[model samples]
Target: MSGGLAHRWDLSAAAAIALQKSLAGQVERADRLGPGGRRAIRHVAGVDVAFEEGGAITRAAVVVLRRADLVTVESAVARRPTRFPYVPGLLSFCEVPAILAALTALSQRPDLLLCDGQGLAHPRRFGLACHLGLLADLPAIGVAKSRLIGAHAEPGPAKGDWAPLMAPGKTGGRMMRIGAVLRSRAGVKPLYISIGHRVSLRTALAFTLRGTTRYRLPEAIRRADKLSKGGAPG
Candidate 1:
């Protein structure tokens, strides 16, 4: 909650999975951003990670942008030795430490976080965005380029159109809505938008759409992606 890495990172794959299940209960599905809602947000940040030296080094990038104009406000990059193996659902264990480090380097924390990974739309309903949101205690959204779980009808081939992403619930065989499949740009692949923490699915969808520009990815995330891959200095 204090922008610190509170949990242990040297966890086994089994332990990490157990931890995710345990922490998933703490994810708040409701909006916590107060009455102002979207207007309350001024700065938004995007987080992403990349591998280097053939996967030995893990690089993380954080780029903060003005929500109104999408101008870069602050950016940071951090690198660490990759300790965890490439586990399918447990990627947070591999990426979060460096992300926290990169976040610490920021001069100011953004009002919202947009992560390039899954959130409630995960197999256990807890993914990188959820993990980072809980640790950072900030409103966050997952803007994944691909689906991690669930199924949905294709979104309309136009910007701002979306469809609900549904998956099996715990009871009654009724499909539970987890996220949204959003078309950020016309005729391009849809993005999976999900609540990370302290945010509603509707708010997440709205913000993701608001943040997107001419590309399939949001502007903040697109810049963060470039930074993570060593495209340019912050």
Candidate 2:
């Protein structure tokens, strides 16, 4: 773990909330991805978690794909005894250890990560993607199936249309931008996109759209989800 974000995972609910608040400030909400100049994003990773043994075990799967063609280049899955109880806002505590293990098993690190959870859109402004990105020091984005916080108008019916998701700021009477509600596919429900670390919201949206084809979620995330649910890894 990075020095600033280093902390224990096993903690009381109050401690977890406090830890989130402390680490949330470390998440960089800026664009720092790709191979610097003229190099396109080549490898992108998707991470998801599933439960087994009636939720006693946490299964984390990571799928790295070729960015241009969305072909699986590498994949890994890790199983660990669930360490924390299901907490609404403290999801990273329950899932990130196994996720880190799975990521460590990969042959090479991906250029970007798409996490199946929230990011800066959470109550503490630090969700699973933010936590994982800080721990791994990788550019990451959150591609959530549903909203965890914030409110927004319905996105347009067409694919690629999006609307800003806003929430009340710490100070009263101020609305802060948290994430975006995106229509990944025309006929399907919109997705919630947010910056996890080292990437801007616009860049996150672009990469997410580039990774989506014929589905409401990105192909990397879809594959990772399947693997996390016990599907064979490629």
Using TM-score as the measure, the top candidate is: 2
- TM-score, cand. 1: 0.94
For each candidate, what is the lDDT?
Answer: 0.88, 0.91
lDDT string for model 1 (34-128, tens) is 32344488888999999999999999999999888988988999999999977878888999888988988988878888999989999899988
User: Which regions of candidate 1 are displaced past 4 Å?
Assistant: 1-5, 34-39
Candidate 2: give the clashing pairs: none
Candidates in order, TM-scores: namely 0.94, 0.95
Q: Candidate 2: where is the Cα deviation over 4 Å?
A: 1-5, 35-39
